[model samples]
Target: MDKLLSIVIPSYNAEKFLDNVLGELVKCHNLNRLDIMVINDGSTDQTAEIGQKYQDSYPGSVRLISKENGGYGSTINTGIAQANGRYFKVVDADDWLDSKNLDRFVGLLKRTETDLILTPFWAFNDKNHHKHIPEIKPDDISWGQKYYLKEQGICPVPSMHTYTLRTKLLQENEIQLDEHAYYVDIEYILYPIPYVKTFEFVNIPLYNYRVNQDNQSISMTNMRKNQQQHSLVVDHVNSYIKEHADGLNPNQQELMVNRLSRMIATQLKIIDLAPIQMATKHELSSFYRKVKDKYYFEPKDINLPMRWLIKSRFNLFPVIHYLAILKMQLVHY
Candidate 1:
């Protein structure tokens, strides 16, 4: 029997793009190798109808579930629970994979049986017909090199929404998404990164991420939600470093902490400037304290400006942290 590959798609009001996304999956070079499961998250639109149409057309190859709206995290968690494949993958409703590269990926997985495989994605805009590709060293790449590629501005990748993970890892870790308005992927993706023993990356672009200006997921205005999610990811990563990452030199620690601090500052910008509920203030304060206490050190030990900035707001830095965060988006866009 062929090993089953489960592809989970969490959808919400995505009818406009679901057809194109599902069509790519159906036309993949190895159709028999995949079991596509799409959990329609209470889409108030025709998303459910579209999914049903695909189910009718593809029958056993495609399965669709219409569940109540529960944000992206809950939707993906539900799909993961129902998946029966030997390996699993996730695709955003807005993104599509390159059908031409499907067989190459499946063949690689069949041969290596790696725990996780990450392939590069093409981020495209309406002005640019071709996908924007990120740079990476061609050969002699280590897992660490591939992992930190984004940090050095070489890979410039985030949101690994197209990764294929072995089912055993999910079952083993009992991995589930956190139900925050943001950071769902971080909880599912980064939380597991440090623990992965056998991970691989392919240079080929297997996914297309549509970055149209009108797309809700790509809105530059929703900086608050995006930054908060980014903060949660960085905090989780920093914690992972302290506990799991060992034998790091001073330079590496500085680099990691610097990145984490910058992300925290950026997140503060989102929370401070955005219109959020009053109750969220406490939650944000708690998060800030956790990060502050963990990283607090003598001012003289590091960069002068960072030290002064950290000290000037000693009690009020979290507030200033939020203000400076407004410009934090400069790093991303």
Candidate 2:
């Protein structure tokens, strides 16, 4: 029988959580419809062993792929190549799905023809034990109803963690993310925009996105260290939006604009957290000027430090970043 969904689990030294991840999935009523592919990306630990055990138990339903470490994007690239299911989803090794929502989500999958499926995801703060659902008002858009982004109202941008793209679309475009780099997830989400003609919103918060891990890509310290990789993705996305601007429909164009807005805001926060010397204010000024010149957002319109930073003509770079970091402490970038 053909599978409905290929849930790719990108694993690396994830043995601590791999069993729990598989254990929860195995409990799902629609397990038969799931192709659970665990990419053991150079796990020196027991991740491969545990994944093998599950594969042995579940046969084709669950499987493991071993490879040299090429980072998160490489594992996903491998999964896309191996997946045989109709729909594709990327689940981090440390993150797991909601078992109760599995059956209904799978049922939706069996009937969905939309190119993009957006669901809500929970940001589970590991240190604080607080859970946050990234807001997407499903009521604004009809469920299972196919529509172009312009005609329907979707909460501007959806997280990669909560989306499941059609396998055919990804493979057709040869969607390859930059391997061995952090922050490639944004590229994964934005690069596919031009190809996404139809979309569906599933209201369920199905993905449990574990947050606050010290070494996690989104962490402040990691983002500072991986700033080069971060810049790579930012530059790629900036150019991508420019290249596709006229090609996108009104709705698609708005969506892209909103997405870029959020992306720019996040980039500002990342820059704020970076250890830039006050003497090297030129670096911050140069970045600010380029982004401001690239997009036309009224500097005074939005209630963010970036707005003021944009308006200041780079003179306030040091003071602005100091203010931005204070807000970053409360919000997840």
Off by over 4 Å in 2: 138-144, 153-155, 275-277, 293-303
In the range 213-298, model 2's lDDT, one tens digit per residue, is 77787766776788778877777777777878878776666666676666666666667665657644666667767877876333
Tell me model 1's lDDT, rounded to 2 decimals.
Answer: 0.64
- Could you list the CA RMSD of all candidates, in the order they appear? 6.3, 2.5
Q: Tens digits of per-residue lDDT for model 1 on 1-333? A: 464688888898998889998999899767777788888988899998999999999876788988888888887788778877788888888778888887677666676666667677777664445567654333445442234322322122245554777887786767767653565565565545543555566666777877644545434466544775666666566765586457444434443444455556545445545444554456556656776688522223344434444455434445544544544433222
Candidate 2 clashes between residue pairs 3 or more apart in a chain or in different chains: 150-251
Local distance difference test values of all predictions, in order: 0.64, 0.80
Task: Count the clashes in each prediction.
Answer: 1, 1
Specify the poorest-scoring 10-residue window by lDDT in model 2. Answer: 296-305
